[model samples]
Target: MLPNPTLDQLQVFLAVAESGSFSAASRALNRAQSVISYTIANLEAQLEVPLFERSGSRQPKLTEAGTAMLEDARRIVSDLEVMRARVKGLKEGLEAEVAVAISVMVPTDVMVDVLSEFRERFPSVSMRLNVGELGEMIDLVASGISTIGIGGAIVKQDDSLSIERIGHSFMMPVAAPHHPLARLNRPLTLADVREEVQLVVTDSSGHTKGRDFNVLSYKTWRVSDIATKHHLIRGGLGWGGLPASLIYEDLQTGRLVALELEAYEQGEYPIYAIRKISNPPGPAAAWMLEAFRASLSRCPNLEAFKAQLPFNRSKDAIAAE
Candidate 1:
């Protein structure tokens, strides 16, 4: 009967396979070269196969059998790591999974960067992410569907939810170059905007069902997401406000022209990180909150907006007032 190989043996085999030499594996694993050779030999004896082609002058190379088994060994080692992490997380009282909802208005590049760091920082903590428009993000947190939410400033204050102002993004009104509003020779007035079709994003959560923000036009086209609004505006369908970060290229390339409207020239939108007051964030979620704040604070456009603002407010003060 074949003997059962131990994890230690498999680990040594993988180290030698990767390092290409038992001596190199010894340095990596902090063990004597003889110990690494002995472990590999035992692993080979138990498996009844020679894993490495032994040569006196050249580096050890994986045999056909070694190549075939390498992937399985890697998978086993990976699964063991995940198991160890989960066990450690349990010991530390960390939640097994954390759900976070992010607003679509948040720059996708920034979101990707922060979440990538988050994965490395908390490998054991599984994440559930939801991207929504307007108030849908906050609704997810308030309704217990998500542990936390990163989104625009909350309009309706509730004692059940805690809000932290992370940063601000600038929203600029824009239209396609061919759109009628863009052709006007002079600065646009409220009457000019009121005559044109305004592309607006509707709240998916129904919390702000009948509310209209910065709506000056009587004729409107409503969409549930920002991408759709951007597409429609680029097609010369209508005009509306979009995050400056999202439309920077469009503005620079003349694909979309900024509207110099009298009533709504440009506006700054506050972004927030929200969580239910009853269910405070776990360690992983708290780490994510800080990651988001740090990422946004470093955004160049947002930094410019910060410089232009009348006064700077700390996150705690913004949350408080």
Candidate 2:
């Protein structure tokens, strides 16, 4: 294996790559032109490859191998930056910035509001957003790639992390305007749905949570994208359990209606704001968590049930249900 190149060599490489002239790179980096040339020379020696092709008059240009090495050098610099950020974060008392991941099931608008509030309060803080499956969010938190995560209730038996029930999000079985359920006056019985087609969002391995819709004969139309599922339901394709936040406007506009069920509560999952217990989050992350709670409280449509609950509910209460 090749020895790891020093950061100084990578910086010189980047400066020359960007400026296309050793003299120009020296000027930009405030170093001597000979030093810049020697740094690149040393890097080439270490890597045992010619990084640049010299010409009589034209500026030095990258060879094919140099182009690939340039990409690797950029990644090395990025990794250094992350290390610097982590150390700087520890020294500066949470001003150095951190990434937080949240699932897409949460409303984008609400996240925007929470992030905007966080930015205004801590102007120097930085953030990166990762939107993925619930499992991915949990992994980000557990692995320390992210300081915090917002996701749905993880039903598996792992106990590596802690969860806070910041809010309650229920899934409403919704269908388009002309769907048969929209015309029903009374609550639809579980038996009424047995024969109906269903749309579901499954995991990477094609698994979905919640109880089986036995009345519908356990049929399903699998779709990956949440937006696609919403649109498919709107197009009168099939019924599915969608987050209440995503369907707020549609429910009000009469474009979609929640199906009544004998056991309406089966599809509900507690919206969790999680962090690894071993890694107490930095102040900026904590602020975002608070802002998330505030946003949930301010949503009038959901406030009735969510406003009264503390971010961390008793485990007994969670398990009692």
Candidate 3:
């Protein structure tokens, strides 16, 4: 096995190489010149290599081996400094890792904004993002699989978690322009909706078992993700509610049409940042929560919803997925 050089010796060697002389290295390290020279000699002896040239009457110069090791020494010292800083931050209530469960309903632009800022603000802290739909977001936090959850929960929220209303997801029933619902082109009654199919987003987590939201139709189809449901709706397969942010362009281009229902119409659902009361958010988590709230409120769809349906104060489709 190769002999190991001590950290002190490597540091001394680095100082000498950087300063170009033993006396300058001693002054920089606040050590005696003899001591600095001795440390370098011991390091070279341990590694079995000549670290400096000792020619008469000139400042000390690094040999090829010394020059090569200089980069390695700098890297080691830099890594040590980073580790020390991270540990210091951790001790000061900064989370070592921030794990968040996100809902698809949260405006995609808001999600992207919060995530990008979080990375830049907390370079030392690790991050985990789990994307889920509806109740799955809340379940991840309740089960301690995530540090916090960002979304709305339909069922009576469990008392064990702390729920903070962050913003709103403007939801409304929509269908393809050519669908039977749009063909009627007037206010729809419950009977008219029940006769058609409704596409519902189903979560495998079953966190909200035995609970159904906004299911007016007797003939319903369950799908796993919002993308598939959106695809089917665009294809005129069925009608269902979607968060306005996701289908803004669709609405503008008439790929889908918002339906006017006399009996039932979906509206704003409160988006929440949920966390277990026992596992409170650390510094990083708190920062993200604030960022999410401020950013979500400015969502173009949420603003559109506010303007388009000023008179519509309908209670949202909580698990409307």
Candidate 4:
């Protein structure tokens, strides 16, 4: 192991290197000018090196070796300060920090509620939240780029990850209340749905891999964002499937209406709390996951949503694979 220099010695070295004058360093350190000179001299003596030279000036200048050592000394000083700060934070129960990635389809209100509850329970933990789609969130969590992922569950299985199904939501066909189909007295058949232009929301890459609801195989028009999709649907431009939780008020107020599709597939993608299998979450991350689970429990829409996503195999069994 390498010998470690005292904090006092490193401080004096940094002061002299930064101020470039022993007298200036003495003033900065609130010590006598002789003390700064003696500290540097003793440090050089112990290390057996010439750290500075007079170079025809009253104040010394760093030698080549001293310039090189200064960089390393600066880094070491920074690391020590960071370590001290982290220790102080931990002792005060303020060390918690987490970065979270969430899906945009989840309501802003839901996020606010989760954050409110989480802050109340763990006021020390500072969270950084990023909202995007499922694929972006998956990439972030899988790469250890994010501490926890919140959003729609992965439809496919990956051996490198473990997904915990913390909650579920239902997808239902919706259209603007005044749309022609909403006035139809009969149940909507496949042929009827195929005739109407459908509005779909996808990512920037224009990929609609797993999100296509099987109910409508109509002429699909794709938009790149959820907000745009909502606007398009509200404007009566097309029909689309939206989360029931998000559109409940719209449905009740007659701004949007749920379309009844005949012979439609009722499917539910698991809403997961996904984390990489190789990187188990730390305390802050784990607490956030638990908080999400708690949110699901108290949410009134969850019970009906779980019924929609009936699982043949338990989440524990799926995670085991």
lDDT of candidates 1 onward, in order = 0.83, 0.72, 0.82, 0.72
- Model with the higher lDDT, candidate 1 or 2: 1
Cα lDDT, model 1, residue 81: 94
Which runs in model 4 stand beyond 4 Å of their true positions?
A: 1-96, 105-109, 203-211, 298-321
Clashing pairs in 3: none
Question: In model 1, where is the ten-residue run with the lowest total lDDT?
Answer: 309-318
lDDT of 1 by residue, 44-125 (tens): 8998999999976578989999999899899998889988998998899877998999887687788999899888988888
**How far out, in Å, is residue 6 in model 3?**
14
Q: For residues 1-321, what per-residue lDDT tens digits would candidate 2 score against the true structure? A: 766678999889988988998999999999998999999999999888888998675798998888998988898888787777667766878757668888776776788888878877765566777776646677778777888888753756447687887765556677775666655535777666666778866554222354343225366787776778899998888877777777877876666766656544544456678888887877888888888877765654444533432333223432343
| lDDT (10s digit) by residue, model 3, range 1-321 | 597987788778878888888999999999999999888888888989998889874788888988898999888877776687689888898998999999888888889888999988887788888988878887799889899999956577688999989888867788987788877767789999997999998877776777777889999999998889999999999999887878877876667877887465465787898999998899999999999989977765445563653232122321121
Model 4 poorest 10 in a row by lDDT: 310-319
The lDDT of model 3 is 0.82
Candidate 4 residue lDDT tens string, 71-143: 8898888878767765665786543677888876555567788788777665556678777664766777877
Candidates sorted by TM-score, best first: 1, 3, 4, 2
**Candidate 2 backbone collisions, by pair:** 194-215, 194-216
Q: Top TM-score: which candidate number?
A: 1
List the candidates' TM-scores in order.
0.83, 0.59, 0.68, 0.61
Number of clashes in model 2?
Answer: 2
